[model samples]
Target chain A: MWKTVVRRLIIMIPQIILLSMLVFTVAHFMPGDPFTGIIDPNVDAARLEELRRAAGYYDPLHVQYFRWVGNALQGDFGRSFAQKVPVTTLIGARAMNSIRLGIVSTVFTYAIALPFGMLSGRYNNSWFDRFVMIYNYVSYAIPTFVLALLFIYIFGYQLQWFPTRGSASPVIPKGTAPYYWDMFYRLLLPGFTAGILGTATTTQTLRNEVIDAKTQDYVRTARSKGVPENVIYNKHIFRNAFLPIASSIGFIFSGLLNGSVFIERIFAFNGMGDLFITSITSRDYSVVITLVLFYGVISIIGSLVSDIVLSLVDPRIRIE
Target chain B: MATDNTLIEVNNLNVGFRFGDEYYNAVEDVSISLAKNEILAIVGESGCGKSTLATAIIGLHDPHNTRIEGEILYNGLDLTKLNEKLYNRLRGNDISMIFQDPLGSLNPVMTIYKQIEESLIYHTKLNDKERYDRVLELLNQVGIPKPERVMKQYPHELSGGMRQRVVIAIALANKPPVIIADEPTTALDVTIQAQILDLMKDIQEETESGIILITHDLGVVAETADRVAVMYAGQIVEEAPVDVLFTDPKHPYTRSLLNSIPNELHEDGEELHVIQGTVPSLQNLPRKGDRFRDRIPWIPDEAFDEDPILHEIAPGHKVRGNSWKYFHFEGEEME
Candidate 1:
């Protein structure tokens, strides 16, 4: 298992290098230059050359790439053009908040999708099953941004049950009961909208997988062996049904990382997505490239984790 | 654990399925009884309801979608009348089934030992140690080598024949009074098929449990079955002691089936006698005629009774309806 993880990590090295190279090439060719934002209109041509040369903008593409990659490896992502701060420092603070939400939303999505999906699939065509189908149809048809807006209007504006904007309220301090509770309370609307965004499609697919799993000959064998209906449903049928769902973990994990983009925007949360929007509009090349690479690394790691998880659940996969 | 001579008695049972507004009979009024240590093999062409009848006797059908009539008498109770809860108690403890497609018949994710342990866990009061030992013992009894290592393996790791052994081991783990083997050897190679039949025969003799072996192979029936019932198009056309039916078969379908068997005397390109017509689909089944009539159209009308019923013409032997006085196949009649 360790060997497999190590191998996957090793394979990810070239992928990251290739990806960074592509991004670097594109960033250089973009319509505007970073120096333009901070150009001294009064500076002599020689002074401008000094700034460009110091910034490594006058070097060959490969030289600039190696320098940036070397610094990135040491936890430096250059400086943001618009902010005039270390790109890492700018992203680090926002990245943490995004990750916390990512973890919560990931846990919430599966915790909600799995049990309900299996049950809804097992008792398909029943009233609850029909209700779940309708739920899937609604969640799928309406864009997630709209759902986020609806959630903000109903729960935040109308009901006054949750905070409509920001990561937390300012009244509570850190490490206190109200602070923790308030944080959770404040996250209710955005977190929920983000968590529920893609669950309908996932739940529906899981339901169909469960239904298909029940028809396998092994399930019938279990039934014939006098296994209780519930036991057969859970131990045999659900185990197989969960397989198809396991294959989707990488996508879910990736979604959790950036899946909150629209929700974060509507709720005014200053996370990666919020930073991403502002950075792109201001043409902050360093920050944009860092965010993209951050997302890419997380997704690759997610796929690796999913492979290990599936192999553990199914021995047939591990041996091969 | 009553040691009654009679084990399972399937009375005139009819199992039908509901499609839209119409109900289709898959297994027509069938009656058979199994005694201790008896092997009653149900033989037929594909879709002839052999498997369906066996499934019905085991209460595999749900009454919601399936319409069943008559009784499955076991231990003074009609199985058809028993609820799912009671059926659970009786199943695997008193009756178990060995399914077709052994590779697909055991849960792919579960270890072989766990699959066998299912019955022991449900039916026996033995602790984990005893259950574990019994599972290994079952694996040994089914002629699987190195049961200790095999216990840790999943279904896919084993060969088709080994998987079938695991299936048989599971079926026999509880020492159920009756076992239904539904085309158990159909998916196996010819040589492996012989080995499995031999193993079942030995197990049956040792336990003296009645087995209802469902298969389409007459060769298998001749080797292991004590008695045989020939089914065609949802009806049993003939049933008798294995030796008697093979010697003096009374139904035309049964006679045709016997004639189609190849032997060394046949030429390589010999046009094998083939039964011509397809079994009618359940939805289009004839309501008031011999189910096999369309397939044997050359036979005189006088030879067939308008409505065929199983009538005993000799001791312990019965033929359905009548086909003239004798059945002649392509001008060759076996008297």
Candidate 2:
């Protein structure tokens, strides 16, 4: 399994490089020029041309792509023309904020979903099961942006429960202990909005699978042989049913990053989603290309981790 | 003279299930006594209620739609009235069962040792070390060489015959007085089936436990059964010693079934007879006295107009018959 993971990583490097080149090439050719936005438009044409040349705009697309790729290989994602900071540093801090949201939501989703899913499976077709099914459908039908806005209105504006705009309090002093706590508190509303919808879908689907697993003939044999119901459910049914769900964890994590784009925009939270929006709007081509490539790498690695976990859950799977 | 060694006395067992609006009785008024150290085989065609009776004996019926009336006396205790906890204690310890498909009968994910150790852990108060030793010993007793290797192996790693042996090890773990094998060898190849049957017989002899072998093959009954009960349409139409059932079958259903088994070694193509019609469905049973004849429209009307009740025909043989009919051999009828 470890060998398979390493091989997959080795294979993904070229795909990442190709992806980086394509996104960089496209962002370079986009209609807007960042030089006019950042450099003074009032400056003479000669000075503006000099600034553009220094920024590598005078070079061919192929040469510029190779230069960026070479810098990226050495952990330098170039300087952002809009922010006047290293692209790598800007993305690094934003990536941490995104990680906070991803980790919090994923943990909350599973903790709430697993037991409720088991209960729904145990009492299949009961009122509880139907209620969960209805809940899943209702939550899934509403868009994430709409939900985030609703939560912000209910909890932030009207209810005065949580602050709506920023990740942390302005008065707590930046980068202090209280600042981090304030950031976590503000992220909670959007985090829970995402978790509730994701967990509701997983609970309904996994409950159905677990119910089917419990009805297998082996379960009947176990019950007839006098094995306790709880043992049967834990050691046999859940273990078997968890295989597909475990594999799906990779998909959920990858999707969590993608889905956060809208959630961050709605709540003005400073994360990868906000970074992506700012880079697109300002035409910061280097940072936009780097962030896209970074997301691609995360997806590939997440899939590899999921496969390894699934192999551990079911002995029949061999990664190699 | 008969000795009083009966372990389980099943009296007038009537089991039925509700299908939407109507109730269908699968087994009606079937009584049989199983003695210690005896192998009684219940043989019948598919859907004959043999397996239903076995499940009722073990209290494994679904409580949603099933209703069981009649006493299953195991050492003078009625099993039907016992609560779930008490019945659970008695199941693997006092009575165990083996199923038809050996593959589906054992949990695929569990190790052979864990599966065998379950009954011992539940019924016996032995420490972990003693339980391990007993599991190894039971595995070896059931003809699994290298019990240590088998202990760590899962069900899918073992062959069909080996898996069935592990199942037998589990059945014999608590040394239950009765082991009900519901067509234990039906899922195996012919050669493996013979070996499993012989192994079961040897196990019965060594443990001195009564076995209820539920099957449809008369050949298995001939080889292993001490007493035989032939069922048809949810009733025991013939009950006799193994030899008597094969030789002087007094019920028309039993006689037709016995004739159905092709005797290639003895009778060289003499038009082997088969049972004429299908068994009646439990959902639509005809009225009394008209059931047997009306269900089999293919059979001649005169042969089955009267519904035959299973009655004693000789000292130890019983059949569903009156005094007029006798078993015929080589075109000669013996009264």
Tens-digit lDDT track for model 1 on A186-286? 76667677777768767987899899998889988887888899999889988888886786777787877777777778889868988988989998987
B1-117 per-residue lDDT for model 1 (tens digits): 134788888778888989998779888888888889999999999998998898887888767789888888886689999889888887888899999999889998899989999
Stretches of candidate 1 above 4 Å error? A31-39, A175-177, B1-4, B264-270, B333-335
User: Candidate 2 lDDT, tens digit per residue, A53-75?
Assistant: 88788788789878877877899
Docking class of 2: acceptable
Task: Please report, in order, the local distance difference test score of every candidate based on alpha carbons.
Answer: 0.85, 0.81
TM-score of candidate 1 chain B vs. the reference: 0.96
Of all native A–B interface contacts, model 1 reproduces a fraction of 0.73
For every model shown, what is its TM-score relative to the native structure?
0.96, 0.88
Each candidate's chain A: what TM-score? Answer: 0.93, 0.87
Best by lDDT: 1
Model 1 CA RMSD to the hidden true structure, in angstroms: 2.2
Off by over 4 Å in 2: A1-69, A153-165, A173-187, B1-4, B265-272, B290-307, B321-335
Complex DockQ per candidate: 0.80, 0.48
What lDDT score goes with residue B222 in model 1? Answer: 93
| Each model's total of backbone clashes | 1, 0
Q: After superposition, how far is residue A234 of candidate 2 from its true place, in Å?
A: 2.7
